[model samples]
Target: METIGWGILATGKIAHTFARDLALVPGARLAAVGSRRAESAQAFAQEYGAAAAHGSYEELVSDPAVDVVYIATPHALHLDNARLAFEAGKHVLCEKPLTLDVAAAEEMVRLAHRHDRFLMEAMWTACHPVIRALQKRIRSGEFGTPRHLHAELGFRVDAPPEGRMFNPELGASALLDMGIYPLIVAHLLLGPAERLTATGDLSERGIDLDIAITGRYPGGALATMTASMTSYSSRACEIATDRGRIRFDDFHHPDRAVFTPYRPGRGSWAVEPGEPVVVDGGEPVLGRGYGNEIAEVGRCLREGLRESPLVPHEQTLALLRQMDDLRAQVGVSFPV
Candidate 1:
């Protein structure tokens, strides 16, 4: 197909953002939107200028006009939603944390490979230009060997018990909702961890309210990450090397990063620290940066690629395993 047609599976906030950004892509068109309620579907389709409004996911996937489907449902529904799209012979772009557990994630990947369909986890941060540039620099060995990485993301959420944030039935937990960002940063910069230990505070509902994770990489690198829903944090990420350190203030949707050089020891003859060099990620395009990942999906479709190299299936599975391990350590469980 010359122009890829996109269908959104849900009418939630994240779905709306993806719909807006899909419009900004050059070779993508939002052809349809699906929701449980017909009225909700119609309203979303009208607002996004989509041609079709599907009252159910079945109708959306059966619509021949839609070449690909973007699953924007909650964490618990991702696996089944993706299965529906894959069974209907459409490519899928599922939201982050792919699934609640490694087994589910593996099943999704296996299904994709079995059907020869395109599938990717929508880890939008990995698609950002700033992250790409940082990876390039790290590979180039410009900052020496990375020794330690630290990242934190937290915000106060005062939602009701039934809300997605605090609802155990909806797969609510700080580690899955917010901690994934910091973990993604660590994995991107330091690869997979050889050892991991975690501790967290749990809510009355048996959900994690705050979590702290420490990992040791195979190359002797260390990473510390934290996420919380009970307090506020800087939401920053720092990667320290022998030569210098890179800092991203808003690591999830980073638009700027600062690199600072540091020297060890208090010797008078040691060279003084140099001024930090700033790198800007240009400007935000189409709804807080979802456009980049949308464009990536279009590119992969056009090239007949089934999986994105940036957010590969293996990486997605590995991250899911890490999260599963963390939850096991913290004694947090969600209704499967």
Candidate 2:
């Protein structure tokens, strides 16, 4: 095919979103889908109008028509799935958190580089234009050299003991799942953190119910983020800068956010709509998942870029390293 063709390796909810979004981009094709079960793969393909489906991951990766693969398998399989795609000479966009831990993420990045393939941790929030706008405004001194951030991503999960989040074999934890979002967003706005203080409550099976973390980055910038699988949060992330604070209504994966200028010694702030960057307001793309990341993978394939600047290998690794440390502090090690 002349256009970039995508192969989705997994039939999870996020995978469906990715596929649905992939269709939105011009010249992008939902070429195929792969699932552990043939029925699941076929069902996903039919739902997304994809051309083909494969029962096994290897089959999907090696499909000649597929220019790239989006791996939305669980965290534990991220490394393996991405490596298989790279070996098959296809670009890969793996869902976050990129792997179970930093070591796995590092190995995956190395594998991609060694094999000369594009690889990216599909942190969809990073590619979001609204997020980009926020980052730019913050960096441009519009937010006055952002000094602090308050963020959280959490929702109660009352799954059975054998559920994915509670399954030790799945490398499950709130820090690695819900936690990565706030950490990554902190990195985006405040850059790498220099100090981290974290605490959490773990389940009997070792899953985290919640984690509250504080990071102090270079230049005294600080970010406090909390994530949990046992509670709800109204605000996800916020930034307080030297000048003013930026507010994200739904901070982690935001659709619409606003910037308020902080005037020194002034009781109130100014919320200047930063051009109101808005995409088509409609039902979300659901067949595969967030289409922007899938489209980005396709764009990289077409242009031959080895990775997404938005979700770089180092960033994923660093964030995971921090998360690993936090989990360690809380004594929440996965069985693996």
Candidate 3:
């Protein structure tokens, strides 16, 4: 396979991580780095060993050497950055939350389809080996008929009001930034929610500080998820089924999970538990598993795939719509 040239559209922390991970991917090269400031872009390029550095996103997207552009900009800029890349005939692997809202995400998807360019929301968790193993177990019906799920992700960030976590202008909200993790795991395990209810607390800046969501799936499975930036949480997920329960600690980037089977004649609330089987994610590729998604993008590009089957366009839209609905319920709206 020919090497794929990657242009990073931002010099943010996420961009640094992606560039670091790109080094681990076979046939993937960090061909360019772009930022609003020339100094920032040049520094990132020097650090990442990119062949080119552009002072502006337009310059980066227009680089003929860049086969794909990774949009690691803030959520607010995703739509424009992605559009610019697609217009330049570059495939896109955008940071999750895709855009500030469902409408923006839809527009990006439409443009990608119309342009015949590959586009995928960089939900790296969807490409992890651990997640694949869990999917396999679910498909094999090892845990019969999932009934309930509980997941949470939270951390305390004592940033000032102007910080990204509390700034509505920057598309800051616990639900969109941190809460998406729990939502992603729920979607992966239980599929889209048929109905959902949400409650949240907001900052003085009108940003969501915390959010709690409960969803009911068409299959009768129930999910409870919570995300917060003002508190600390275990960041875990548990899926209960007729046969047993699967527990994943730090579910966002899980390294292992445990399945505890239920014995016959034991009620769902019974204390008698069977032996627990530990499933490890095994050794990840370099860059702590981010390479998985990078590899997936490379494979899709090589195969002429416009979107990954694992993280399809429909899934991204569905998730975005869910977030939109949740935000509406909580009365949270971004400037975008």
Candidate 4:
């Protein structure tokens, strides 16, 4: 199909953002929305120009009108939503850290391959134009990436006892939410960490309040990163290479990256300012939270692709494995 019909499976803030953006994005249309409550679903559809609404995820998955399903539900529900969508013969593009663990993620991948359907982890930063440029720079030897990298993504989520941020059963934590950014940045620079040293503090409900991780690559490339929900820090992502370094403004969300190259003659560094370098960072990317991600799903569908090369299965697996290890090191465990 020239344009994709999106079935959004949540009515959360991100869902609302995505629905709004989908309205404006090329190659995308709001086919339907799903939520546990029929009223909520109907209200969302009416507010967002969706042609249909389903009170339950099952109905949304089975909606014959949709070409793709954008699983914007919580991480714990991603696997199920993907499976349902795959069964319904729809492509799947779910949010970051797609599943609670690698095992679940593997199942979703296996099913997608088995069903001959497309499935992609919604790591939007990986597909963002600015992050793509950074990757190209490193691949081109522009940065001579032979050294270390550091990325930090955190926000103050001072939730009360058993709130999502502190609730293990809900899979709430900074690492799964904000920490994925640093992990993705590191993964782009250095494939998988050969050696990982990690630790973190747990909330009262045993969810990770915060975590600090250090990963060593095969060639001695290393990454030091942190994620926290209890406190706030610089939402910066930096990749250091043998010749220079690249840093991003705020979160990697919108990809305003700056490059610094070592200057032998100057004995310091030459810099490429972040986005809008020519004029305050170019045309800023205004967005509905899920807009770009929905477009990515459409692109994959039109290409007859099963997985996004930008947010490949292996990378998602590796990042989740890293998180699992980090959580293990910190002794965070959820009750079954």
In candidate 1, stretches whose alpha carbon ends up further than 4 angstroms from where it belongs are 263-275, 281-287
Tell me the tens digit of each residue's lDDT in model 2 across 272-323. Answer: 4553333222334322336666666666667778887777778878888898
Worst 10 residues of 3 by lDDT: 266-275
Query: Per-residue CA lDDT of candidate 1, range 1-336, in tens?
Result: 689999999999999888888888788899899999999999999999999999999999999999999999999999899989999999999988798899989999999998899999999888887787777778788767899999999999999999988998888999999999998888887888888899999999999999999999868999999999999999889988888788998897788788777756745224445557676655454456788888888889889999999899998988888999999999998987
TM-score of 1: 0.94
**Which digits, one per residue and each the tens of the lDDT, describe model 3 over residues 1-336?**
499999999898888888888999989998999999999999999998999999999999999999999999889889888989989999999998899898899999999989999999999988888887787778688777789999999999888778667789889999998889888888887878899899999888788999999999858999999999999999889999888899998787788888888766776435444557676656574576778999999999999999999899999999998999999999999876
At residue 3, candidate 4 shows an lDDT of 75
How far residue 196's Cα lies from its native spot in candidate 2, in Å, is 0.8
Better of 3 and 4 by lDDT: 3
Kindly report the root-mean-square deviation of model 2 from the true structure over all alpha carbons: 3.2
Give each model a TM-score.
0.94, 0.91, 0.94, 0.91
TM-score of candidate 4 relative to the true fold: 0.91
* Stretch of 10 with least lDDT, candidate 1: 266-275
Local distance difference test, candidate 3: 0.89
Worst 10 residues of 2 by lDDT: 279-288
Task: Give the Cα-based TM-score of candidate 3 against the true structure.
Answer: 0.94
- For model 4, the superposed segments whose C-alpha errors exceed 4 Å read 264-290
Q: Which stretches of candidate 2 lie over 4 Å from their true place?
A: 263-267, 270-289
Instruction: Give a tens-digit lDDT track for model 4, residues 17-117.
Output: 77777887787888999999999999999998899999999999889889888888878778888989998899888878889888888999999999999
